[model samples]
Structure formats: C-alpha cells, structure tokens
Target: MARLLDLRQLDLEQIDAVHGRGTSWLYPLAAAMSGATAGIVISGGQLATATSAGAAAAPSGAAIAGAFVSDAALVLGLASRSVGHISLLYGYDPEEPAEKLFILSVVNAGTAASASAKTAALSDISRLTQSLVRGKTWEVLDRSVISQVSKQFSKAFGKRLTKQGLGKVVPAVGVLVGFTLNWTTLESIVDVADVEYRRRFLIEKYPHLANEEIPETFSDDLSDDADEAISVLNELAEAGGPDLR
Candidate 1:
C-alpha cells in the first residue's frame, strides 16, 4: 500500500504577502513551537533572512525592515505584556537604538501606552491601519474572494500546510487579520485563523492542551500596552516559515 502525503505548496511571495512584508518564522514560529514571545533576539537586519523549515513564507531584506517598523507600532499600539521568555519591555528601533530593545515595564491599554496592549485592540492595530488604508483601495480588495476566505478560514490548516492553495487563503487571512486586528488585535488569537487550525489539530493530536486548559494568555487577551504586543515581531521576515503557520 502507498502512503498518502498531505502536500501543501506555498510560494515565497504568497507567504510574504500574508505575513506582511517583514514577517519571520521566529515569533509565529516560536509561538507555534515555543510561545508568542520567546528568548529570541536578533538585529533588525537579520530578521529578514531568518526562516525555519516550518515557515509558510519567506521574506526579503526590505520586508524584514518592514516587520521592524510594523512590530514597533504594534508593541506601542497593542501594549502587550510578559509572555513566554519575551518581556513587554522590548522594542527595536534600529534607526534610534541600533536594534537594542527597551522593555515597557508597566502594561496598559485604554489609559496609557504600556506593556499590555495586543493586536486585537482597535487602537493598537489602528496604528498601522491608516497607512494600509491609504496605500490601497482596501474596500475593493476587501470584496475579493481571497479576502472573503481570509475572513472565514479560521484554523483549518497547520504548520503542516500546503503553500499552494494559499493564494486564496493567505490573502484572506491577511485581509481578515489585518482588518479585524485593527479593531482589537487581542480580541482574538494571534493568528486568529491559524491558531484555529492548530487548536483543532491539537485537540485531535495531543488532546492535552484543552480549550479551557490552554493558557488564555497565550491564546487571546487585549492590552493597553500595544507596543508590548508588537516588539518581537517588529524585526522578522515576512515570508515562508513556521512563523506564518
């Protein structure tokens, strides 16, 4: 008998598009393997080149630089708090600090920018929303079938995904995550759609990380400290790798 292979074909470009220009497999990859934030730190420039076998996308140096800026905005916007080995105090400003990060100590949301804000929070995510809105007629893209699927496909695949069909899925994920995230990033999961894919997979595979048992902090929570949420991701490659998975 022959074994069936669940082959998923993903392109470097598609991956980069979904994860945004400068996404990396580290944080998302770390979140999948380790946690959202991990004991990982690299230069703003190095992030664009880093990617793991698990990566669904790969990025370029330009994208890596984009990630740095994006993540910085998220950290300050979402105001994330301490999770895993990564603290909310970290933020990379290559232009200012030469890639050295500073922790935000206290995390807050509605009041002041601290270390608790997450991507789900409207304010936190909005930090990037305007720029994106101006760049494209988002209204038009939002109507595309790709965007449609991005909004609907929640956690249906895994790191063991095919890079092929994502032409539709990735954009959908991007549009949905990008759009919904702007409202309140932490309102849902990090990869709100991808996590759903893993959550369902975990329930079937390990059956240990239960819906209620899994640490809620790792799953979903908003923060006034949006910056904390954006720190680690600011410098990653926006291409194929475990990060997007």
Candidate 2:
C-alpha cells in the first residue's frame, strides 16, 4: 500500500516544492470545479422551475443561492487546507492543530466577506499571524474565547453567503455568476495566504530583523491585483448583482 504523506515532517524546502506544485493549478481548478458544481446543482432538472397555470414559473433565485452556499463551503475548505500547510511551512507548530485550523478559518472568513465588512476580520487575522510568529501557545485562548470567535466568523460567513445568493438572482446566468464568484473568492484567499506565509517566512529566515517590520514585497508576485479584486467584489456585493465580466 502506498504510504500517506505526512506534511508536518516535511522540511521548508520540501514543503515549498510541494506547495508550489499543488497551488499552481489547484486554486483555479477548484474554483472552476466548485462553480460548475454549483451551477449544475442549482440548475439541474425541474428544480429550476415550477408548473403553474400551464406556465413554468421562473426558477427561484433563492434556490440557486442556497446551492451556491453549499458549493462555496467545499471550495473554502480546500483553500483553508492549503493555508494550513503554508502555516506549518512557515514555522507554526504542527502540534497545534486547533490554532492552525483557527488561523485558516479566519483567513477564509476574511477572504469571503466584502471589503467593507473585512476590517474586523482582517484585524483578527493579523493578530493571529503575529501570535503564530511569536510561537504563542494555543492554551492561551480559552474555550469561551474560541466560541466567541467562532460565532463572529459564522455571522460573517452567513453574510457572505447572502451576498453570493443575491449576486446570482438571475437563473439564466447562474453558471457564469457562480464561476466568477468562486474564482474571485479563491483568488482572494490565495493572495491572503501568500502574504501571511511570506511574512512568516521572512521572519524565520532573518531572525535578527524580526524586531523590525518587514516591508511588503510580494505584491508584484501575486496572480491578481488584490485591492482591485476586492474592491470589485465589494461593489458587486453592495449592488447585489453579478456583473463580473
């Protein structure tokens, strides 16, 4: 039997190699897969229409929106898994699975929300990133604290789902809307992961300079313009439409 790969045991160089290969195509593919899945699930069969007075009523946008939420969850989970690996590679201890999961969850939550709603989420992610770099123990965060954080994130996630549903209100264009939303969301998540991991990587490589704030240097390497992408998504969410073209 083929042995399972243990990501925790992999050294930085090995981890980098694995991540590079895995993420190069993973985000796009996952986004496409999730979008297609959402479109199909939402548009499949007669679920998109109801018979009434010998006329088929337009499919309920709410139904499509509901399907999108279920599909987006899977995409977010995949992105978070990559974020966890990057965290481990950047010196976070693998023994602290809860902490790692929490970080990933926060990052995903931040990526999902509109820019206007992202301030608190981003702040939380930054604090957690800093703590991880400082080697803080997970025990410092009690269950109540974790519960509260989880509740806040849950609310943010719900808002995001609502926005997504509103964006796909037109049943005729469900496929395109779903595709754009998933792709943009995953792209945003990847950018956040890159920044967080790169920051930690710099801190570990130059321990002497750890006390100094490192200048942001990874923007040139990002696949998408992060600010522009987030801004567009926020506008879309605010307008409650999917003019993503």
Candidate 3:
C-alpha cells in the first residue's frame, strides 16, 4: 500500500509560513516559475546532451541543487493556495497563534467537507458548529509526525520513479511522468487542505454556535398519518376493544 501524508504532520514553521503568506502575491509568482523550473528538475539541464541510459542517472551537484529549489517553490505555492482558500472562506488573522493551532488541529482531525456541505456552511456559520479543537491542546509538533510524513513522501516518490523502470531513462518520458505525478499529488493535497481548512475556520469563528441542536425534518403527510393511527388505537384501548356495529 502507498503511504499517505497527513497535512497535520506539517511542522509549526511551515504552518506559520503559510499563514504569513496567505494573501501575498508571491504565490501567483511561484506558480509561474514552477512551470519553467519543473522542466529543469526533470531534464537536469542536459535534456539533449546525452542519449544513453546513464544520462538519466541520479542527480548530483548542480542538478541536485536545481531540483531542491524547484520542489521547494512548488510546495510553497501549494501551501499558499490552501491558506488563501481558507482566508477567502473565513477570515484569519495572521497575528493569532491560537487560530493557527486550531487550523493544525483541524488538519490532524482530517474533517473534510463536501461541496454541498461547504456551500451550506458558508451560507450559515451555525451549520458549521462542530469543533475540532474543543477540549484538545497542542504545544508543539511531534518529531515522530515529521518523520512519518517524510517517509511517506519518500515512499511515494520512490514508487513513481521505479514504476517506469527503463522508460524513465528517456528524458522526454521522464519529464512527462514527473510532471504528471507532481500535478496529481498537488491536486490531492489541495483537496484535503482546502476542505479541512474551511471546516476548521468555520468552527473556530463560530464557537458560540457549537453543539447547537438541529431539529429533524420529516414529511408532513407521514406525521399526520402516524398521529391519526395513534389516536384510533388510543380510542380502541380506552373502550377495551374495537366497537363492532
């Protein structure tokens, strides 16, 4: 089975960084840069310089440095969008650490909302009263969580790289595979991050509405029929038997 990474496992530094850049223009800039750097990471600046299988060997020196920079920007861009989306749904104060912690807790709880749920909650804050941070406290990000997340990322990338086997030796095919994996992974991360953040933001902002009872809605026709049936049964019981004419 492929190992999965939990957004909650992200350290406080990363969380804070995203919060800080939630509304900055840098995210759009990074998206533009990634379009170019992504190719560099796959071809290692030697796309056509070598045709042998060995040309696609593990990166070293400049290639390693290039890949590192490119990937970091990609991840930052992804995080920025996630935080920005939350901000759009429920305003956040970058200056508030408690709010950030609540966001982290929501990520930990993995409380994702569907499109209909999101629309309903956005329409009415009271509908999003469930709290993920209630009765929960967190002081620091655990090292084990970080380690587990790292392992999951490594395993995912390893599987992708190894799956192509000899085909990856071709720079063209490698670029296609690398780009596809990156795009798919980004989409998955965005889906989880967006939904969870929206969920937490609503609950945190509407704490007063927490635990509010929701009245169940039933069909009026069914209710009337049930009431009439019960009334008839009561009359019969009161008379000790059904009257027969």
Candidate 4:
C-alpha cells in the first residue's frame, strides 16, 4: 500500500533554513519521512554551534531528519517511482519527541501552486533560460469536479466535515489529496461497530487534535483535477468495496 508518512513538523535542527526554500524544503520533509519508515531510527546527532569555547550542543530532531535523508541516499535505495512523491513530511515540534506532524497546508498550497507557480519555479531552479516555459497545469480543475467527488465521497463515507481540529485530524484532512491513494476514505469515516462513538471516533480517533474553532477562512479546494480524482477514490474505499459502494 502507498504509505503517507507524517513527519510534517519534525524538524528540530532547522538546518533547511540555510538552504532557502527550493531544495531546503525537500531535505527536512523527505528525511523525517524516510526515517519514519520501517527500521529507521534517529541518530541523535548534534547541530553545528557558534564558534566559541567548547559549548556543548544538544541533539535535535532536525538532525535526525537530516541524517535520515543522508542515509537514504547512501544506501542507494530509492522508493519505487510508482509510489509517487513518497509522502511529504513536514511540521516541527518545539518539545521533545518533537511532535513532527506533517503540515498539510503546504501540500494543499503546493497543489495550487503547481499550476500557477510550478513552471516558473522549476524554470528558475533549473536555470533553463527559455521563453516557451509552459505547464501552468492546474487550470484543468473545475469546481463541479471537486464538489462532485467531494460530495460523493462524503455520502459514501457518511462522515461530517467540520472544522480543522489539530494534530492528526488537521493534517489528515488537509493532505487527503496530497498523493495518489485512498487516504480520503480511509480517514473520513469511523466504523460504527463500537459503542461510544465520541470516545471511539472523535475524542480518541486522534486525541492530539486541537479543540480550536474552525478558521473563519476555510476552503475546500476541489479546483485541482488531481485532488478531485484522489478524493473520489478515497470516498469509494471508505464507503466500502463493491459489497458496500
């Protein structure tokens, strides 16, 4: 199965700040992701410190994320391209264990940017001095397409879409369409097979989710065709197989 590892907010070292957005965004995101995979453990490395008299430095998750990225490269091991982006790990916790939750906002924003900014961004990074730069590809998405699939999946799953909670729920809903898979349905509905729906689903489903009120500025971006397709697939699965759907 295609796994979307959640390392969104795990960067404790903040090393990527040195590289700027382009590739920097990649190191922290990918490293924590790879580390979360099977058998991957943190090295607890020390970060570079200011040039001063031997001042001891504390280890960081940022170091972990960075080391993990390096290790994956050293092993000459790459995830199957068919796996697509291999999940985008993000978020960085301030405390220990560094609650490195994946920041879904970036992905949600990234999908839109792919249409409006992808070409220029890629061109700028590649230094490909050319005028024919195309690929403002996100224009292909339509509201109906997004709403249709969104509603379809909602009906199938029979779950209510409310506010942005926090932790798991926040990240899960935001990144539902990040990759190509059935995560939407997988996360949307909870099995009613148990009593105490609140305990089994809401309160316990993802206990870390914040109780913050839904942002007044909320949006359901179904304008991206890629997002829409993934949404439909997730709904189908959540609704149940042919026996259920």
Candidate 5:
C-alpha cells in the first residue's frame, strides 16, 4: 500500500525547501523530451535501413514489424524518462518526510484551486490564470485526482508515441518525426505543472488563503480509500496542520 502523506509533521524549513525546489521546470520537461526522442529516432532510422535492404517481408508484415519496434522504443523511452521525473517530483525516497510533505502540498494546493474556481463560477481563461481567490481555506486532498497523475502522464506520452510511430511509417523520416514527438510530449507535461505551481504560489502569497477551515469532501467519485484519506487529512487540519503563511 502507498503510504499517505501527513502534512502536520512538516516544519517551516521543509516547506520552504519544497517551494524552493520548484525552480527551472524546463529541466524535467527537456529531460523527458530528449529521452523519448533518443529511442524513437534510433528505432526509426533502423527501421528505414532494414526496409531499404530489401528484406523479404510482406507489405503487411513489414508494417506490423515496424509498429512493434516503434512501440518497444517508445515504451523504453517513457520508462527511462519516468525514473528521473518520479525522483524529481516525488522525491528520491518517496516514503520520506520531505517527499510526503511535497506530495501533500501539491495535492492540497491543486484541490483548493480547482474547488475555488468551480465555486466562484470562474470559467474564463483569464479568471483562472490571473484572478486570485482571497480568504478561501484549504480543501481536503482529493486522492482520486492525485492517484490519476501517473495514468494521465502515461496517456499523454502514449498519444505522442503513436503520432511519432505514424511518422516513422514513411521511412527515413526519423529526425523530423522525433522532433515533433518531443515537442508535443514535453508541452503536455509542462502545461499541467505550470498551472498547478502558479496556483500554489498564489495560495502561498495571500495571507487570507492560508487559514484552515472546516474540511469537506469535494468529489462524488471518491473511493473508500479516498474517503479514508480525506478523513485523515481533515483530522490533521483539526489538529492544527501547518498554515501556508
């Protein structure tokens, strides 16, 4: 079982450290893009070369073989990229205090931002991007959403891989295909991180948003595990969890 994050135990210094670590989002974005491109380009080039060598494979057979090779390369690339990203976002030791603190902070901040947006009926892009909600307290962490983070990333990467695979079908188009694949893959990851961090920063900056209020369940799709986690977080809040200020 994955251990739950308990934010109440975090000291002020640890919170500061986590906030400071948000610098240079480009590092992870570039790393994921480059790692994925390396495998895909190499695979594409090899596939082209093999086809040119006049291998005695049927048309459909060659297509199937090419897909398998491309998929294998993409999977390997995603796996390699995930290791570094997981370490950066979730911490070197996931079960450690700092790691737990960072996870909880990200979850709570994101949950708070989403709920605030809905409650205020603020659907305008500028409202979401520019306006800050004052005096709204933190919400219970929505485990359903947080649990889907890995799945969402995988889905995004898979789509990019598929697009790149299609490009490789033309043969000898490895370099251009890899460039397109990398750009799309990194953009998806960076966009989510950018919005989440911006909300977190806004919440931290405004004094009124830091206060703890009564915690309420926000999601109708919550699992039994999610309910249990929310209860624990609410209990922590009642016990005087760390304030954003």
Candidate 6:
C-alpha cells in the first residue's frame, strides 16, 4: 500500500514536471503557424494527409472534417504516449501481458459513460486497481464489457468530431479552428486519464474509504493544469492571424 501510494505521488509529480517543461514542439509550432502567411499551403497539406485516397473526389467540407478527426486522433495518441510513461513509473511493465492488462483496465475506465454509469465504473476500477497493487492476478475483462466501453468511447469521439467539424466549415478560419480543436481534444484525453489514475491512487491509499465514493474533486490538481493548458492554446489561436503565418 505504501508502494502504491508512493507511485501515485510520483506519477503526479512526473505529470506536473512534463507539463511544466512543455517539451513537445507540436503546441508551440501549432501556435506559431496561427499567424503564418502560408496558412493555405499548410492547411491544404494537412487536409490532404488526413484524408483518404479518394480525398480528391470527396467534397471539400467532408475532406476538412476528415482532417479534423485525423488530427485529433494523432494528438490523442501523443497524449497516450505520455501516460504510458506514467504507467512505467507505477511499476507496470509496458511489454508484459499482465502489465498490458492493467494498463487497458485503467484506459477503459475513462471511456465516456452516463454520469451515474461512469461513477459506478470508476468505483469498480478503483477496486480493481487496489487488487492489482496488492499483487493479485489480473482477471481478463469480459468481452461484453469491453464492447460496451468501446461503443461509448466511439460515441464520445464522434460527438467531439462533429462539434469540431462545424468549426472547419468556414474556410477563412480553418487553420485557427483546427489548432484549437486539436489542442482541446488532447487536453480532454489527458484529463480523463488523470482522473482514472488518481481515483485508483486515492482508493489504494485510503483503504478505509475504499467502499465509499471517490469524487472527481480528488483529481482537480491535474485537471487544473489541463484547463490552464487549454487556455494557453486558445490564447495562441486568438493571437495568430492568417496574414501573419
């Protein structure tokens, strides 16, 4: 239990350090491009890469929507890689089967669900995390459960894609809109991971309250940083102009 608690604290510290350092060049590059004179060239190239082979035959709007989803996935993948590092710090071997199962359990906990349903799932995952930390063998997740979680995640992703797609409709603002949407999506994915892990951390540390609800409030430290990052990205978007790039 002490080991679990220490690992949790270490995870939080590592996350803060990474965000504070801001080592990724993507955000800054995206911000700088907001005011680039070559906005059309850059946006066009991005759209072309994001779309399928039949992109030329598709309507311009469809192509742009596809680009937004593609870009969003790429951004989420980057965030996942960062979380993968934290998984290692938690003493999970990224390459081993048991550790992979542990990682998947945490990842699936973040899938979109109704408020009540999500709360219940979080509680269940908190328990599972405790078992894992205590060195219990990992039980395979039910196929039906996996399917349900996948469907929920897909639904959530679709909703976000639709919302961001709307912003891409206006040609003149497409570049800035794309950057903002991608940044926001990335932040959201990271937030969900943070919440999921933090919940498990709390449950492991406070076994007395293990049966009680672990509120989202417990994860506010990470969420606050996510909010700040989103604000910074938005400010950068607002500062950049098509003429400047």
Pairs of residues clashing in candidate 3: none
Name the lDDT value of residue 72 in candidate 5. Answer: 38
Q: Which runs of model 4 end up more than 4 angstroms from their true locations? A: 1-20, 23-86, 91-206, 216-234, 237-245
TM-score of 6: 0.50
> Residue-wise lDDT of candidate 5 within 1-245, one digit each (tens)?
23322332344345445644333344334534553454354455556457664443323545545554555355434433432344344223434332333333322222222344223221221222222234233343244433443334334334434543455445456545545544444443333333443433434455454353323323322222211111212233344542222
Best by lDDT: 2
In model 1, the Cα lDDT at residue 209 comes to 42
Q: Could you tell me how far off, in angstroms, the CA of residue 234 lies in candidate 2 after the best superposition? A: 22
Cα lDDT tens digits, model 2, 60-113, are 567665676677567656666656655655555433534543454445444544
lDDT of 5 at 92: 33
- Candidate 2 versus truth, CA RMSD in Å, comes to 9.2
Instruction: Record all residue pairs in model 6 with backbone atoms less than 3 Å apart, i.e. clashing.
Output: 35-244, 35-245, 36-245, 37-245
Predicted candidate 3 versus true structure: per-residue lDDT over 75-157, tens digit per residue: 43454355545543344442233343233222212211233322322322221123224633333324443334334433333
lDDT for position 61 in model 2: 63
TM-score of each: 0.19, 0.63, 0.39, 0.18, 0.36, 0.50
Q: Give the alpha carbon lDDT tens digit for every residue of 29-90 in model 4.
A: 44234333311223111212333322354334564344434433321122111011222212
Query: What lDDT score goes with residue 138 in model 6?
Result: 37
Question: Which candidate has the top score in TM-score?
Answer: 2
Where does model 2 exceed 4 Å of error?
1-18, 41-62, 91-98, 105-119, 140-148, 205-211, 215-245
Clashing pairs in 2: none
Quote the positional error of residue 245 for candidate 6 in Å.
50
Residues 79-115 of candidate 6: C-alpha lDDT, one tens digit per residue: 4464555555543445443343334334333332344
